[model samples]
Target: MEIEGVRTDRLGLLLDQFDQAREMARVRLAGLGDDEYLWEPVPGCWSIRRRDEAVTPRAFGPGEWVLDKGAPDIPASEYAEVVRQAADGMTVAKIADDWSVGVERVEQVLAHTGPPEPDTSPVATIAWRLGHVHSNFEGQWEWTFGERKDPGLLVDFTPSAALALERFWASIDRWRDSVASVTEEQLDTVGFSRYPHSNDAECPYVTVLAGANLEFIHHMAETALLRDLWRTRFTTSG
Candidate 1:
């Protein structure tokens, strides 16, 4: 559990933060049914439908669900804003100290980076979101820590919420185990992850961690909002 060069105590705190985020995701995904999990609020929304379901004309792929379309634009996170305000000066220690609120509460206040692109953006279902997160987690672990030369190996595309959640936590656990062993010098060392899919391969390990944290925070919020929209929109229509 020791991150090589970071003070053991500080590493513990960082891991605790990660654990909080993961738990928040689990809670948000809990108790979803096939109806709720696969419901698409729009005509072209990407979701886990039957394999024979016709692909939305706007979406790019044919599968049990709609996978990614455009290159995912990573945005500055609302959680990062909290970190800034919490520090009031941008120091990591102060930011950590101020991040005591629950992750769910953070989701409520934080907004996503850009306005949605109606034509280009695919409305994702809960099942897709969980699977996507799980895949990203596994990919990062393989290239960042494991022996896999290609980070994309063993990508999963499970179609059920319950099954997707299981894989999500399993992938997350492996990722958590990998980071627990990273050393302080390793955090600053570029190419530590060697993840080829993004710029993280050339960036410092700590930078990769920051990006991963942002992903968990913002994507979870999006899924939660989608669930709310499903309830409101579908209920009114029916």
Candidate 2:
């Protein structure tokens, strides 16, 4: 199959994956109200909050809305599972795949000898998940395709659901554009993406693109699940 004249090669596959993920996200986000967007299913959930209301030790973005992120507190069971996987000779990639997170994130968890600090990795609100996914696209677009300028502390964290959806869509478009513009030579080139968040600088561009597609796929699925939970929160099983 061909997409916009691009053959169904490696690059095409990546783009197709991204397109499908984006469409799923769009459908999942439709008619998302503000209350649902910021709904915290449990206490101490990390989410997009007003600067004054921020609870995390460190919050990113200069806007009135900040994203809460910290060293996630891994549950004892989860930590043990990682150890068990490692003992079973599972590669980092396999462990990461099982956890549905990036290898680097999995490595970080594995590097720790004990559980993380308390009040960390709280259940995240839909807003928080959307913010995280949007940030990845925005940051990668800035470093990879746009001027290799650092976005600095100027992240546009939107507190309103409507505005957040708008920004998220724009970011997706930018990321898709960047991926679509890559040439075969560029895909094989090292350091094709100057994205500072990961090992993109050391790996081939194709590796970076594939990793990003995985990120989008997993996060969007997670966000969709959150929406489902929100919709069914008040339902009775009887």
TM-score of each: 0.67, 0.78
- Residue 114 shift from truth in candidate 2, angstroms: 14
Off by over 4 Å in 2: 1-6, 72-120, 152-154
User: On residues 1-238, what C-alpha lDDT tens digit does candidate 2 reach at each position?
Assistant: 6767776898888987888888887898899999999999899898998989889977777778899977433454467667767886889896776555788877877887754445334688889988888887777888888776555453688779999988788778877886888998999998988877655676689988998898888888888999899889889988
Backbone N/Cα/C clashes per model: 2, 0
Error of 1 at 111 (Å): 26
Stretches > 4 Å off in candidate 1: 1-10, 48-66, 71-120, 149-153, 234-238
lDDT of 1 by residue, 1-238 (tens): 4567544554566677788888877787778777777777677666544545646433222344445434333223334565444444434443333344444444433443555323445678776676567667777888877775443335545566677677677888888888999888988888887765555655678878878887877789898897777667735533
As a whole number from 0 to 100, the lDDT of residue 123 in candidate 2 is 84
Q: Could you say which candidate leads in lDDT? A: 2
Clashing residue pairs, backbone N/CA/C < 3 A, model 2: none
